[model samples]
Target chain A: MDTKAYIASGILELYVAGQLSEKENLEVAEYAETYPEIKKEISEIEAAVLALSEAAAPNKPLSFEAVKNRVELSEDTKLIPLNRGRNRWLPYVGWAASAALLAGLGYFYNQNNQLRSDIKLAETEIQALEEQIAGASDSLEKTTALLQTLRDKNVTVIPLGGQVAAPEAYAKAYWNETEKQLFIDAQGLPEPPDGMDYQVWSLTLNPLTPTSVGLLENFQTDENGVFALSNPNQSQAFGITLEPAGGSESPNLEQLYVLGTVSS
Target chain B: MQLEELVERFKQKDLRAFEQLYAMYARNICGAINTIVRDEVLAEEICQDVFVKVWEKSDAYNSSKGRFFTWVLNIARNAAIDELRSKSHKNQKLNLSADYFVGILERADDEPNGNVNTDRIIGFIKNLKQKCIELIDLIYFKGYSQKEVSESLDIPLGTVKTRNRNCISQLREHMKQN
Candidate 1:
């Protein structure tokens, strides 16, 4: 394109004047972009026009803020969100902080209520244990009275000695002939290990046979160290052995902790 | 850095950009309205109105259409013309002679701070033929197209562009001198 001819064509002057049609205006805009000379010429023309128009302005200067207010009013009518940072207000700041604090308080209150319920649950568990201790002490007194009855003059006391399996273990049996009850004191034996408990048996010496009695269910936890057994058989001797928890039908001879004969 | 970039920011509702653009063209816009209205108070009012209108209708401006100043110029001229044609102005004593910009230049001679000297402008304006003034007044100030200017000035169809070029060149020389 002949840049000089385009410049001399005077379209740039009208371009500055804004008198050109849309198509012509776009063409001029393209030329202005492609050629610096065209752009310079357009600027010069615009500068000249600007000076002329400005000289024609009234002597009095108008307020820029008054015009800005009108702009703001129109913006409000259009519901455009204004930049609040440029114009600050105290109420907006206060309201924002209040909302944040409200949300934080609501979260803290919920956590507080949960902690209160947990504390209540722990208090209830402590009260229930106190009742169980009181019941255990009451049962110990009744057991002591039964022990006193067996130690009478008609009772037979058998001294059981520890056998080869456990020489340190010993036991004693108090037999009551009339009542047909036997109380075994196995305090000389150690507590059975986990998954196993001590079983007692009554023996008849003539047949050399042993009969199952009962297992000491609370051998480890029982404080008194005495076990009550029913002796209905005509037994001349009694033996105590460590059997399985449910008790065996016959005494475990290898596991026999003690043996004694009842003197008639 | 570019004027279009500045105007685009203004369209996006950038206040700093708007203020810069206002500072750049506010005087020219006010001057243009004052030339037609001839009332300083009314000119200030219309100038502010024109700026408000510019901001409100910022989306309507496209660089391909014209310069930013030209777009603002069109707004100021239209607003001034509308005020002139309104019922309030129509009933008043229309002081037609004092309304032209040349009258302001003539009256400024008596004031101490009148930077625009009438003799200098008239001398520079003399370089432009009588036809140049009529074409400039119609096309630039009145927002008339070549066809309209040609019909108004009784000029031939082909001469409007060349004549306007000559008139603008004279004004450009006058601006360079001051």
Candidate 2:
């Protein structure tokens, strides 16, 4: 009945160390739940042990990525039993042959249906393969086009570093002065909040006049986080701001994420 | 405890939850393994494998059985022991010295920046008795049962529990003073 005596008995330490039997552990767990002080004492014991063991660690903890990959791989291995289950069907055919002649015809008919289903499965698998090949080609073409745009000599590369709101935010403006087109690499930018899109701007210094280039629409669907927009302004600098989905008529100076001056 | 919630999430195969638990206990688990295997590289490898096994066998864990740290600590010890008994370790004939956790701190003057918190553990170990270190190492680090500890330390069966109590009280006191 005395909590102090219970705490001093040191059973709680053994309980935390898992030295107690199942019955003893359950009793301790019950007592801990019944008495808050018991629970606190248990935690303190655990904390002390944890500190001692942690100090013996030889190196920093390994990242969880390795653990995750191995665990997921084992998870995937479970699905493989489905195919192994199919192989058992072949052994059944041999047994059916020895069982009786009358059963042979029925077994053949069943095997015919199984073969038909297998053919259907193979056809669907081929369709999946075709779709994958088509998807890969589509991405390859897009990558080639993106590379061409990046390599174009006329394009001016403006590095827009992160702003105060999002310190990690980054974007690049690849402007083609002759074509009046700008490609904005907003890879470093986080996704705009719902109903918000990042809008680009062309700024002229001295008077500090700002002109809207274009809004980066369908930001989510745009792969590679690169958007191409028309910019037809003689500007000394470029800036990007977050605006409503439809975009604002002017750049919101307060939301300006990245800004860079055009160096002649 | 909030850790119970994290353990529940871990049982549900939440990787983020698993990561949170790992960060909390990895050092302790790895340290325990290192204490047994006495090989930093091998202990690290086994420590990682223990976590992966824990993830695969998460269904085997819950509060009713024991503390999550206790469960993990057992796994780490068993894994490190297995490594010690394996052929490679046998050929090496590792002496498997009786160096307890405090020994790491005692030897820290030689390697000041060893992965361990030399300053903090030194402060803790400075006032700790040799008996306290040995008892904690046996029951806590080595995963020895009370009966085993009693036999190994030649202490009376009745005294093991209370003796460990006093020893841990000293540790808690040291922690408080620091």
Best-fitting candidate, measured by DockQ? 2
The residue-level lDDT of candidate 1 at B72 comes to: 91
Q: Write the per-residue lDDT of candidate 2 for residues A1-264, one digit (tens) a residue.
A: 899999989898998887888788778888888999998999999999888877777745467787788877778678676766778687897677677776877889999999999999999999999999999889889989888977899889999987776678888999998888899998888899999999899999999989988888888898788899888889799989999888899877778888888889
In candidate 2, residue B63 scores what lDDT?
64
CAPRI classification of candidate 2:
acceptable
lDDT of 1 by residue, A1-264 (tens): 999988888788788878888888888888888999999999988876776666666766656788888887877757844554435666788888999999989988998999899889988877887777666666655566766766687788899999987899998888887787788888898888787778878888877988877787788777677777787888878888888777787777999988999876
Please, what is the TM-score per model? 0.54, 0.56
Where model 1 places Cα greater than 4 Å from the true spot, the runs are: A80-264, B91-100, B112-123
Model 2 complex DockQ against the native:
0.41
The candidate 2 chain A region of ten consecutive residues with least summed lDDT is A53-62
Could you give candidate 2's per-residue lDDT for residues B50-115 as a string of tens digits?
999999889998666788888888888888878888747688664443667676655554566654
